[model samples]
Target: MSSKSLQARYEAAFMPNYGVPPTVLVSGEGCVVRDADGESYLDLIGGIAVTSLGHGHRGLTAAIAEQAGSIAHTSNLFVNEPEIELAEELLSLLGGDARVFLSNSGTEANECALKMAIKFGKQHGRTYFVAAENGFHGRSMGALSLTGKAAIREPFGPFAADVRFVPFGDAEALRAAVGPECAAVFLEPTQGEGGVVPAPEGYFKAVREICTDAGALLVLDEIQSAIGRSGAWFAHQLEDIRPDILTLAKGLGGGLPIGACVGFGSAATIFAKGDHGSTFGGNPVSAAAALCVLKTIASDGLLGHARTLGEQWAAELAAVGHPLLLGVRGRGLWIGLVLDGAHAGAVQEAAKAAGFLVNAVQPDVVRLAPPLIITAEQARSFTAALPGILDSASPQE
Candidate 1:
């Protein structure tokens, strides 16, 4: 079918949650995608950082095919070999004896973590959860309650209570807000949706101390910043801090839908028998895919590759010296370009026109999370196209 016709059908049949579609992407290979009309575009956004190995990675494809051919799914009642291996690999990467609760997406992971927090709190007489301002957890009622954006929360009236918001990057604010009544302190190591902002130095340590003092769990939402996206197995590792509960999803399955809520030490034992479960959680196919992604990343040295490429990519962006470009922030392949004004939307459109995909978090912030396997040539192509794209987005006087 024609792209326009497919889009029309989508509008007529689907919900309006995501608004009008962008382009009807038909196929992809590596970091490039082809539209229905056969136009190719570099996917810098990488499905908002979920497509870690980019589209149609051979190892991941083969793993999925092999697993599906053998045993696709057996539900959570029966323990699966792939699930066991994936959990073991994840725990090993995190450098801890963590028990994992696998799910289908980031929201489900957060939901499970939140429930575990509540259970942990109830056992110890705590009830509140303190999250950072401009922090985003998920859209579920429990996760939404912890999210800091009031505009989104206000519309969903009478949400789960006992959740408070503190300023991001402010150690003092976190220390002041956390108390004995708090069940957990949640944070995103690097705020992906919040303009790719990183916490100030000593913030994670201070937050960890405060949570320890208050007897609350430290939950780090690493859905966007984990799995070598930030040049580390987890972004929190960059700061030498550890979280009691860690939520991961985005890149874990290498494009397959999978998420894990892992708990360390006492936090790991909060969920008793029948406390929570998911029918499709830890399905063999997704687990096999995740194991393959982890194995590939480790064996191919993609973590170090991401770090090298990210530093060079940031340097190139800095050298561009576009008047509208404010600066670059973030680590690894996850980087954000702050614009001088609210022209990010225009800049993104221009980038798309130039055969590259980017995202505007706010009007003045554009986020780039290319595949971890992106070569230097692809990075240069993006850098070369960026100046022209920025020029086209010049502000009107």
Candidate 2:
């Protein structure tokens, strides 16, 4: 079908939340996607950082197929094999003796963490929560309450009371905000949705100590940074600090939907019988896909690939010396091209027109989170094409 026809169908059937982009994607291979119009584009955003292994990964498909054929879903009532196995693998990767609560998406995982924190805090007569400003958690009620973006939260106000926002990357501000009255400190090691910003040096370690001293749980929202996206299993690992609660999703299941709220130490023992539940949270098919994603990332040595390739791409893009470019930030496959001008949206549209996919995460920040399987050559192609893309998007002065 034509892109216009498919768009018309989509408009007729779906809500107008996401205004339809020009192209309607049909299929994908590796890091490239083909639109309905038979044009291929390097999908650098990778389904907004969800497709870790890129499109049509055989191992992911096979795992999903095998698990679905065997047992697609068995509610939270009965334990399933894939869920158990995936939990074990995730705990092992985290390098901690942690318990996992499976859910359906990043927001759900964060919601689980929030509930856990609230329950845990209530025990100690605490109720307030601390989160970083500009931090993006999910759109769910509880998660949105924890999110620090005012514009996103204001529209859906009457959010949970007693939630506080501290400036991100400011250790002193975080220290001041987290106190005995604080239930938990929810933060992202790197602010992914806030323009791919990583925490300053020693920031997380400082926050960890602050939360510890305040008797508050430190919850790291790694939905966009975990599962090898940041060239590491988790972004906080770079600092070697362990969080009381860690929320994950996005690339965890590659393209499948799966989320996990992992609790460690005392936090793991907080939730008891009748505490919380999700019917199709850890369905076998999604669990199987998640397991395959983790295994494939390790076996294929994608972590090292992400680190090296990401560093090279950033350096190369910086070397381009574009007049409108500021610099680059982020680690591994997750990157942000900082623009000197407010032309990120125009640049994103221009890149799309030139057969590339990127995200204008902020007014002046372009987020690039390609698949972990993306080749160095493919990355270079995008970087090489970026200068012209920017030039085309610049104001015709």
Candidate 3:
């Protein structure tokens, strides 16, 4: 169907939650997508960082097909080989002996983490959770309670109680907020949905210490920063600290949906057999797909590739020398362009016109989370087109 016809059908049938569709994408390959109008775009957003291996990745496709043909799902009542293997692989990647609870998305992973935190807190007589301002965990009641955005939370009144908000990147403020009453200190290693902000130096360490002092669980929400997006396998690895609970999603299954709540040490033992469960959480097909993603990332050395490309892309963007370009922030494949003015929306529109895809995370921040498999040539193509995009969108002097 044509883009307009599909859009009309969508408007008539679908819920109005996401507003109008941006474009009706017909197909994709690697880091490029073709819209219904047959215009090909360099997809830098990678479906909001979910397509880790990019579109139509052969390994992922084969893995999913093979697993589905063999056994798609058996529910939580029966143990599945693929799910067990995927869990072991994820724990191995984190460099620790940890326990993993599978889920379907970032929100569900966080919900599980929050429940685990509450259980841990009950064991120690604490009930409060400390999160950072502008931080986004998820939209579920438990995760939403920890999310610090008022606009998103205001509409959903009476969330899970006892969540305290502290300023992001302010170690002192976090120290002041985390006390004996706090159950967990929740934070994103690098804030993705909140304009790609990274916590300041020593901030996470301070949070760890504070949580330790208060006997609260230190939970790191790496849903957007994990799976080699941030050079390291996990963003927190760069800081040399281990979180009590780590939540992951996005790139874990390449394009398929999967999330994991991994717990370390005592946090690992908090969830008893009957404490929590999900029927489709560990579906064999999704778990098999995730295993392929992990193996492909390791065998292809995508971690080093992401780090090198990130530095190269950031340098190229900085060299554009546009007055509106303020600075660049974030690590590895996860990056954000800080605009001198609130021209992110304009720039994004211009970029689309130039056959590139990007996201304006905030009024002044443009986020880029290209696939781990993106080539240097593709990066250069986007970088080369960016100057003209910026020039076209520049405010009239």
lDDT of 3 by residue, 169-252 (tens): 988888888888888899998889999998889778888888888788999999999999998889899898999999999999
TM-score of 2: 0.99
Clashes of each: 0, 0, 0
The local distance difference test score of each candidate is 0.91, 0.92, 0.91
How are the candidates ranked when ordered by lDDT, highest leading? 2, 1, 3
Candidate 2 yields a Cα-based lDDT of: 0.92
Per-model TM-score, in order, reads: 0.98, 0.99, 0.98
Write the residue-wise lDDT of candidate 2 on 176-235 in tens digits: 888788999999988998999999999888998998899999999999999999999998
Candidate 3 lDDT trough over 10 residues, lowest sum: 153-162
> Residue 352: error of model 1 in Å?
0.6
Query: How many times do residue backbones clash in model 2?
Result: 0
- Least well predicted 10-residue stretch by lDDT in candidate 1: 153-162
How well does candidate 3 score on lDDT at residue 115?
91
Writing each residue's lDDT as its tens digit, candidate 1 over 1-397 gives 8789988999999999987677999999999999998899999998888888999899899999999999998998899999999898888888876799999999999999999999988898997899988898888898888888888877996876688898999988888888888999889998888899988888888888888888899999999999999998999899898899999999998888999999999888989999999999999999999999899899999999999999999999988978999899989999999999999999999998999989998789999998898999999998998889999999767
TM-score ranking, best first: 2, 1, 3
